[model samples]
Target chain A: MPKVTIDGHEIEVSQGTTIMQATKQLAIEVPYYCWHPGLSVAGNCRMCLVDVEGPPKPQIACYTQVTEGMVVHTQSEKAKKARKGTLEFLLSNHPLDCPVCDQAGECDLQNFYMDHGQYDSRFDEQKHKKKKAQPVGENVMLDQERCVLCSRCVRFCDEITGTGELGIVNRGSHEEITVFPGKEVNNAYSGNVVDICPVGALTDRDFRFKCRVWYLSSQDSVCPGCSQGCNIRIDSNLSRPQHGEGERVMRLKPRENLNVNDYWMCDEGRYNYNFIDRNRIQTASRVKEGVVEEILFEDAVDSLASVLGDAVREQRHGRIGVLVSTQLTNEDLFFVKKFFKTNLGMDAVESRFSFPEGSSDDFLIKADKSPNTAGAQALEVIASGTYQSGEDLIDKTIAGEFDVLISFGVDIDGLLGKEKLDAILEKVTLLAYVGSNHNETSKKAQLVIPSTVYAEKDGTFTNVHGRVQRIWPAFPPLGQARPEWQIICDLSEKTGFSVSADDAESIFSEITQTVSSFQGLSYEKLGKEGSLLSTVKETVEK
Target chain B: MEIPEELKKKWDEAVARYEEKRAALLPVLRLSQDHFGYISAEVEEAVAHYMGTTPVHIREVVTFYELFHTKPVGKNNIQFCHTLACNLNGCEPLIKQLKEKIGIKEGETSSDGKYSFSRAECLGACEMAPMMKINKDIYGPLDKDKLNEIIENL
Candidate 1:
């Protein structure tokens, strides 16, 4: 341990600790662009100037290691003037296009300006201009004018993503961040470049101009787009009274938790919420004799219980099939399985656990599309088929002479090629489809229950790696839709298996009590930040 | 390109004031560019290899930190910082007038290679943007005619 005095505050830090680390530990963040926790240090910004007691010239705290009895002043007049000078010089060539920059509120340059600006423009000359924006990747846009040349995003690609696509082209102030000749900045983690850019230099092609960050209400959640379930922050402006009132998530960013995806999220997860935002089939409408009439959720549930219950009671238990999607939350999966097994005494709860294969990146994630196949497996939910797995549920549906079958899912029909699913649905006498989207199965269902989208539902999704993460509701349920857990609980009451399902805790307990893999997983333990419940892994070290 | 033994020895002595081999990037770039009008890939590669880093890393520093060069240039590098505050005062016309006076475009080297004009990001002189740096000399607070006169005299 070493004793260091930073800004007159005496502090003790571990040996070999940099002055930058000490500053951060002391709740004093040194403004920098080139130094990221995950990457090697390249102190190019020079904005993190500090007056070390012994050094005649100011040292960049990012690279300077703290020694015993060392004194550092980050707020000294000399240090202040030095940082201000650095900022002013940076601004001389910078185009203050904050109005146009997508990274406006969250930009580091903006933060540094407010912290160090002398409130005076010293330049009596013209500003240098560069290209406004260049689309560098499938999901990344580079604005050369807004770039401070800190090279954080460029470093992120080379070091973390291992994709050495982005580089600095040309030279001097004429220098701009660009990809190498003939190569676009296309990498699986290319979106992370937009996240790391200190200035508005790199912007996401997907999130540009959707809504300003100041207006976004953020909620901690995990990406259900894949089994990796990278922890994320869902930012939205849905709480605004001006917009058609509903908490609509505008963007998804990686929350900085070293345990999960470290400051990086896949573009698929970040952009997948767009479908959920607009296409929520949130109404119980039945086309009886082509006269489509909207019915209340209660009436629909009652009818569903009676018809399915009578059909199952008459025909038999195994004849009534059930489909549970891997996309369903742990609580949702538990109750859906329970509704068939306990209430109907029907054991044909066919597993809807399947998706198209996605390629993995060098960063922290699996390419598997469904977030919770492993959890579904724990609940005895088998994959429908190998290649097109969810279709096996329908394959079994065709072979098994069933009177009624209940399938619950989102993205099931899309997974099970449209024609095949449609043809299978025609043969079934009674079909109940529950999901967030109006897929082909939902359209053919005798009863359709609109389940809350992952963003609007608070529950748990077990990622492919067996990491159980908490996905919280970013907004209120849309159009009388309920969380799958609540709806399944409602069905339980109607069918004579009465149980309360007020909170995720109650439902989770029922799951852990019966389910072997989820034995220790309690709602209280399933933190808002999320915990990985992997059956395959060993330690919690990232 | 091989440096003279005298200057190389001098640089070696002066390098220790800074920490790490990479800290010498600015001085090395300036010295090389000064000795032989510009910095080529050969010199940058040799330096980077010796520094135990990639050429791209050194290239990023040279491209970013204003004090480095990556291409062949004229004897004098003429850089003008035309940013927002500077533009408000009148740099647009000044640059246009300078182009006419010098008979050269903004990013072009003179036919004789005696002078090359380019843009500087900030030059640490925001107060003097719309300002021109000729080699090491900085001149600001100018009208279009003033730039015309200055380059004409040069």
Candidate 2:
């Protein structure tokens, strides 16, 4: 380990670590733009200039490697002057569009100007005008004038995704970042460039003009679109009712988790939160004699409990099939296994909701669309006996084997076409559907219970790699919807079993105690990056 | 999409001289430009394929260097020096006279497609202060009459 002193704070670091990284270990701020940890260091931006007690002038901390007993001064007078000169030169050609820029609140240019360079405007000449608001691709909007020539987005496209769609054209002040003529940056990870861009040069078209970032609050969560379980931060405005809309998630930004997604996620997962606010089942409903009616949550639970109790009393519990979705959280899956298998003595609790195979890349995108398929498999929620897979469950339902069925987050019409789903609906006497969205399954169910989405609950999702990560609630559940674990616990209480877990934490504690795979793991132990399951096998396939 | 046999042989020879194929991109680009007169998008793609890189990488290199032309030029390309030494020695007047005679500004070709004119940074010929290159031949150290004679000969 090489010891380096940054601003008089001594710390030992590895040999290859840069001074900028060592300063990070000391919690010292060294302003930088082009040096992203995920991308190769370009070191074009001289904002991180630091003073070193040597023969050379102030060196850029991002490019300078730490040596033994190296002394660095990040906030010295010489370094500050160098940073100030760099900022002045960068702003000489930059447009004064902060008022209209989408990256106003979080722009690095504005931040560094305020922190290091508060000098008066020395540039009285005309500012160079480059192209503005150019639609570079389907997801990205490029403003060439705002670019600081960082090359982070270019390196990302070339190095990370290997798409090689973007490049810096020309030279000097006339230079601009652009894609090849007739070629669009339409890669799967194209949206990540906007996230990595330090300035408003590359803004997300979906999030542009939506809301200023300071007006929105963020909560750490995991993406539910795929089994990669890429960690994310859900940005939402809970007090935006004054803007004529209720609380809603604005966007999903990738939260850095080196083990899972390394500061990047696919555009599919980034934009998948649009369904959270659209077509949601606001209230519980029930159907009687082919007429749908809105019912209270308590009455809906009571009716479902009574019907299940009657089925158990008639010794027809074996015919009662439960179709679970791999989309459900681990806590929800645990409760389902406990209540259905141990308490009700029902042998069939099937997770037969198969997601269509999505396009995957060598990067973070996974073919498995469900985020918790490993959780479902590790907990043994997929029924073992006759109905093994989702296709088998649908086939058995069409064969008139199951008289009653309870489904969670599984779209029946999507699984089987309208014809087969209609045929199965005619044979099933009691159908209970519990989900967050208002899909075809909920429309035809005799009892519909509204469930919370991934953004509205705190639970663990064991990713495809068997890593158990936690997702916190960004906002309250929409309308009368409740967490899936609470719904299961309430239904279990309504029956003969007395399940007393009230919150997600309590149910997770019970899971750690009872589930062998989840033993010795708690919510606190999961932390931000999450911990892998103890019994996770290395050869588990996605 | 087809390279001339001579240029292809030169490109392969240049590639063999370097251990890394990517190091041969500059010479391969120069060979393509020499054979085809200008490096089009298709030429860039061909060079990129030969170099085992992407077209954007080749484009970045081509656009960064003023010597490489991405667009079409006339039969005779004229590159005039615009650095401090040339500007101090009446290069501005020479450029104006050349533009008037050629009937085109910088970065544009003549209407008859006989000549293309561009003002480039120093071509390392500062000792011959007001110098310009006409298709690889440097002519300088004269007035408007000499420039007219050079253009008439071309």
Best by DockQ: 2
Model 2, span A1-542: residue lDDT tens: 99999999999999899999998888999999999988888999988999998847999999999999999999889999999999999989999799999999999999999999899998988888999999999999999999999999999998998889999988899889998888899999999999989999999999898888888999999999899999999999776655315538888999999889989889999999877888999899988777999999989999988888888889888888888988889999988888888888887788856667988876788999999999998888877676678767767877888898888888888877788778878888888999999888788888899999999988999998999999999988998999888887888888878876868899999889888889999999999999899987555332
Evaluated against the true structure, the overall lDDT of model 2 is 0.88
**CAPRI grade, predicted model 2:** medium
Residue A383 alpha-carbon offset, candidate 1, angstroms = 10
lDDT measured at residue A481 in model 1 versus the true structure, 0 to 100: 85
- Listed models, DockQ each: 0.18, 0.77
Shift in Å, residue A91, candidate 2? 1.2
Alpha carbon deviation, residue A3, candidate 1 (Å): 3.0
Model 2 bad stretches (over 4 Å): A242-247, A352-355, A537-542
lDDT tens readout by residue for model 1, A58-160 = 9999999989999999989989888998998888888888998888999888898899875688888887778777888789888888888888887887788
Docking class of 1: incorrect
Two-chain complex of model 1, DockQ on C-alpha atoms against the true structure? 0.18
How many Å off is the CA of B147 in candidate 2?
2.2
